[model samples]
Target: MKRPAGMSNQALEFIRTASTKASWQEKIILLEFVSGLRMPDIVASEFDLSPVMKNEYTRLLIERDSGKPIDLIIGKKPFLDFEVNIEDGVFIPRPETEELVENTLIRLPKDPQIIVEIGTGTGVISLALARKFKDARIFSTDISSRAVALAKRNAEHLGLSDAINFFEADLIHFSGSEILKGKVNLLISNPPYIPSSRIPHLDDEVRLYDPPLALDGMDDGCSVVRRILDLSIDYLSPDGLVSLEIDGLIEKPLNSYLSQSTLEFKKGVDIRGNLRFLYASLHENSFSIQ
Candidate 1:
């Protein structure tokens, strides 16, 4: 069998200079991942794949040099505790977003709770929560149909189909009316918060590949978040908690919004010490959805 390409001195140099701004460990990881050639394969391909003609390896090098993100090139990203499949259509889950899932789980009632996640991009957050809280029934929604399918596939792949239900619709639109209505003990979302004007400034991988709706918020980057806050009063159980991921820069605006709401709320920072999540709950168990 013809051997696949090895990491050439040229390729190594190419990667080194290409990713020089990135740390040494990062560059090594990027090279290994982007080429899709394993260590042994890389060692063997040195002879056959060197001075490459037009092929996948050549394309990977070119793209890497051009600043295409390795995850997008490799078509997946490791998020939370799972390797999530990714494509150009969905939002790439970030480590900071994990804060929403972790904090929400910490605050959930120990007894069985109906937990619903809005805008479940890759099902990363919801799947992790379901695995962590085996006693909980988890339901998730996405405004993008492609995202919904992706989330369902992710759930099924992770053997979580029995524990997680998937739906397609805008945030709270489908959530407020159905088996999910007024019974949810917790609500979680990582809605898009990149203000429209600023979305264009995002990295090419994000601006060019990820779904715009998953990144671009309206003018203030709060359209979807504001809507979610509005519906939490009607959709969440009295004792239910709502946890949302937000841009740290908007802490003051978000705090002001929660101030006027009947629910009491708190914000928490991520591992990077950035304000990343909002936790809100009604004042009492008697606070029914009226």
Candidate 2:
């Protein structure tokens, strides 16, 4: 491939060599390195005009060639309008999860008094909610201590430390559960929904880098989801809502389970048109389905 006008020979040569062994979005990754911009901004800017820090850019190229995700290589990821600090072993938030947050925002009550988030990996969902509902007392929990710590830091960095309460616990098992029971206005999560058997088939960057605790959903992938649903019965308010990001393959079984439960359920597709989001509310206060 002919080198773009302003790209250095070193960068061009590295891309040429790495292309033989690995497949990546070369242009986007390179733009991120040179311009210090997130993917969305990188796409709009002229890459050739962006100044590249040669040594750091070379190091990033080497890391990318070794199959590390660019987010990890850079140690940060953009979610919504803010960037969150990420660490090794914590599950990186995906674009789909951002969509989950936006959809939840639309369906949530105009002014929720209390909100609970299960499996708050990176705390992006809770952070967004705290920003949107400034007065809402938001409780976010994650089983991984590292994730909880990192999430707390992210909150502090965004000046949201006072708005969210981060804790280390599995699902809704935190010490403050008594305070949340029957009072949670909204409960949301992008929990681990990938089946155990499918983990090996995931991309190398995801399977090798992301922690298993954030990926495995056990035998059928609905274990965590089921637990969350059961817990919601006790935790959710009379008019509360439950929104979750789920794997499309388990829709039928989950649908069957929801049918038997007291919550009125609805499912929606992601940007790709796959059924990926599930929303439920107590039958007494059904969703104003849009």
Candidate 3:
């Protein structure tokens, strides 16, 4: 949707200037990009200057002038056609992750597929995929119970509870296999792939506000990716597909690794030209279970 008119550019500029020395203004912009929340809300509830009784507008101006990440202040983010609940416990969903759903939808077969999404997060990916593939039975899992509940809430709020099954599992480590093993026609994942060392270098909003588990990927940063690939082989149907979202920087290494696998895999780029998706097929030409 187009941004609402009458949002004072002057106010935004003031906030920008206020946070000049810090990265808070950039954080606000990023939040706006991700959540679609306006400057009014940012200044109103985020910094809590609107109802302060005295010097309200002045305080709002001062806070904007002081600089603070809007997500830190506003406390939520929107993603993939839905307003996903966000907290320090969860990683805010990104635009590139949406590409994983878009590309997977493009390659889906005519019949139903038992789709499983690993690391469901705020359940944005699963919800987006479920919305697109309405007939597909979606089972979404995450390690965090809070995230699981949040996902469930989002699904029910979107009237998608009947279409999805929510589970709390540690990246396929839980008893999820009882219902998920060898049953998933398609396995989709957006695993944590960021390197441990790089975590400190990320933007303040991400480093400070997003969950660490959602970003850290061990020494070489492929720990979660490798685990997903290794564990998924048995879960996939004979000709079922596995789609993954990975860091573009590791595309070369991942591609080289996938080349040696029995499964055939291909990469897809997102809107920003990032190699955001990895599509793998167990066998060519058929999506049916064998």
Give each prediction's root-mean-square deviation over alpha carbons: 5.2, 3.8, 5.9
When 1 and 3 are scored with TM-score, the better candidate is 1
Among the numbered candidates, top TM-score falls to 2
- Clash number for every model? 2, 0, 2
Give all TM-scores, in the order shown: 0.81, 0.86, 0.76
Name the lDDT value of residue 224 in candidate 1: 83
Tell me which of candidates 1 and 2 scores higher on TM-score. Answer: 2
Instruction: List the candidates ranked by TM-score, beginning with the highest.
Output: 2, 1, 3
lDDT string for model 1 (1-290, tens) is 22235555655555555543455555555456645555666676663233443255556656656766667767778877788777668888887877677666666654437888889988898888888889888878898998989888888888988998888988756644576667888888999888888887988767877789888778878788888888887778867888889886566666677678877767678888887877777754322221
| Deviation from truth (RMSD, Å), model 2 | 3.8
**Model 1 TM-score, 2 decimals:** 0.81
Q: What value does the lDDT take at residue 206 in candidate 2?
A: 96
- What lDDT would each prediction earn against the true structure? 0.74, 0.82, 0.70
TM-score of 3: 0.76
The Cα error of candidate 2 at residue 207, in Å, is 1.0
